[model samples]
Target: MERQLIAALAALALVAGCASPQPAPVQLVDQQQYTKAMRDNSSTFTWPESRKPDLAVLAEKSGPGRDRAPSGSERIVLEITNSCACYLGWEDARKRGDQAAASQALKVMDEVLPKFSPEDPDGQRYARETAAKAKAGDGSQAADYVANNCDSVLWK
Candidate 1:
């Protein structure tokens, strides 16, 4: 009877282990939500007194900064390019006739693009594609592309 009881407990433990809960499903970024988040955090934007961009924080908030950042070339490509969706701000500013704001935002993107490197051909190609869109100040399209292709880290 004791042996049978031990066997039953072992089987129960195995069943319980297998029944562990799964992680939550990823909630992808939505443009309207991203827009609201950006606007809400606008006043808190600390772009630095020296006008230098916080590449690390940008990676964390917008791209793959820490654990998500893998060594493969494709990793940084997705990260910086994904953050390039910031170009959307520039696009919106231009539409409102705010040339000064647009110029500054564009300049910031320009400075950041060269910093995104990919050793592989595929990564390089992707980088170039992102760079072209950023140069054109296509923020809306960029955000859409990031949502579809990259990890869901945009508005987190």
Candidate 2:
């Protein structure tokens, strides 16, 4: 009975370690500003309320109230620690001459990339930087780079 209990606990630990990581929860910095950023403003698409959490990794600038751009508008900012493994998986497939898998990965990236709305200047800048990183390599560390070395999506 003691051996069986120990084995069960070990199995539980293994399962726990295998569980997928959850995205960090996003917080609203300013309700009105967040609302303003969600509207159609200087972009092809209007920011949606549902996709706010998708905004993460970087902001347009530092200092107080950096999340807001255009004075009164705000974008969602989540701690960009987590990464999507799709980019690495895509790399593996291309390396193995697996065109079908590579194509599938491209599709996922397409779906994922547009989540970075270009409406906010910070979002546009982040999107551009992320695209550049995607072309460079596995692209997993792109957000880490932005968070560490860059500001939110501000214009030139």
Candidate 3:
């Protein structure tokens, strides 16, 4: 009975190890390496094709007031973060060879990027350059740009 119980526990452990996904690598040295790592382990995680966040509604729903409405500046920050999320998703999908997912992410990015307020020059530039790369079928530089510049807004 003791031997049987031990064997059963070992079998359960083996099954669990096989079923659980390995964690994504934490420290890639550069964008090219990062992209390679993501592609190699794309099956380890679910890459959701996210929608553009509606800033008006999001701002109205958050912040420090009874009305919970954020300031104009705060709203622009929200827009940048949300847009970057979509951008990252697009690049990630492209790396994974997932055309359908990449297209979905790009669609969201197109809708969100245009709405960035004129006050944000960096946001405008990122939108322009990344969108161009995405459409031009050269996503490597776009991914590198995002890694270098938009690291703050990148998803954890």
Cα lDDT of model 2 by residue, 1-97, tens digit: 1223223433444455457385333322342453334332323322222222233222222212323222222222221211123444455566788
Q: Clashes per prediction?
A: 0, 5, 0
- Clash pairs for candidate 2: 59-152, 60-152, 60-153, 121-153, 122-153
Assess every candidate by TM-score: 0.36, 0.29, 0.46
Candidate with top lDDT is 3
Error of 3 at 112 (Å): 2.5
Summed over model 3, clashes come to 0
lDDT of each residue in 93-132, candidate 1, tens digit only: 6678888776776665555544445334664565456557
Question: Whose TM-score is greatest here?
Answer: 3
Candidate 3 residue spans exceeding 4 A from truth: 1-70, 120-126, 153-156
Q: Rate the local accuracy (lDDT) of all candidates.
A: 0.44, 0.39, 0.50
Segments of candidate 1 deviating more than 4 angstroms: 1-78, 81-85, 133-144, 149-151, 154-156
RMSD of 1: 16.6
Q: Candidates sorted by TM-score, descending order?
A: 3, 1, 2
Q: Write the per-residue lDDT of candidate 3 for residues 88-139, one digit (tens) a residue.
A: 7787787789999888877665555754666457767767777777778877
For all the candidates, what are their Cα RMSDs to the real structure? 16.6, 18.5, 20.6
Candidate 3 structure, TM-score to reference: 0.46
